[model samples]
Target: MLAHSFMSDEKKQNSPRPLILAVEDHDDNLVLMSYALESLGCRFICQKDSTNTVLVAKEYQPDLILLDILLPTISGIDVVRYLQQDALTCNIPVVAVTALASREDKERILKAGFNAYLSKPYMIEELETVIRRLLCGKIDSTSGFELCKE
Candidate 1:
């Protein structure tokens, strides 16, 4: 289902839902994320290949992005860097979702330009919390959420 076309024009103008760009190579992961985003009343564009992630993101103009750190050919960190450099997509928040759970790995991903990080096998609630925190533009140190430096 293409969630982007699901919303009507009136609904968009009245109460628009946040659009998400989910870049993950795993089909199962894409399905799971799609379900989660749908359940949360958010629209999403999913890309299984990282090769064209930046292009797709620019076209979709998502409010946020859920990026996987490990992808075929291109790493998620590189994708993040590309997005950060592109004026069209630079402002969109990107959260890394990957299996790299080590402290150093997390730090490295953050340093690469991701706005937030979510380790693999993350809880649905945790994902929801992170998504909400980012979409709301509430990146406070006291809010128990870690945000990347500008």
Candidate 2:
């Protein structure tokens, strides 16, 4: 339940950056994600487990959520269900960051309410791409993302 914030110096000097909520049970994974999110100029809160995730999400109302599927107390899929049921945090985009890399796993996770999926062992570039798209992209009539008009 350790929460920390990071921002790139340039982003700090400019407009406010996106705030992200990352839920991961592993300390090492949390550290790695913190660095990656920092490099992307995002302010993030990291939760070590899913026990208080719904409360935390409601409190913060971050722009996006990075959730690990296999979490302690409550699984990430279940967490998404809880988040979707709550109006305060329902619209925030959720990305599944998990080791489950199979096609079936990806399909299932997306069907479970995650807006995006990123397999574990992902590169920083991939993480950056996901963050950028979800934060900057626009939701279309079909409930899918599209490049925002400039």
lDDT (Cα, 0-100) at 148 in candidate 2: 25
- Alpha carbon deviation, residue 108, candidate 1 (Å): 0.3
lDDT string for model 1 (94-131, tens) is 99999999999999999999999999898876888888
Q: Give every collision pair in model 2.
A: none
Q: At residue 40, give the lDDT of candidate 1.
A: 68
* TM-score of decoy 2: 0.81
User: At residue 121, what lDDT does model 1 achieve?
Assistant: 93
Candidate 1 TM-score to native: 0.81
All candidates' lDDT scores? Answer: 0.79, 0.79
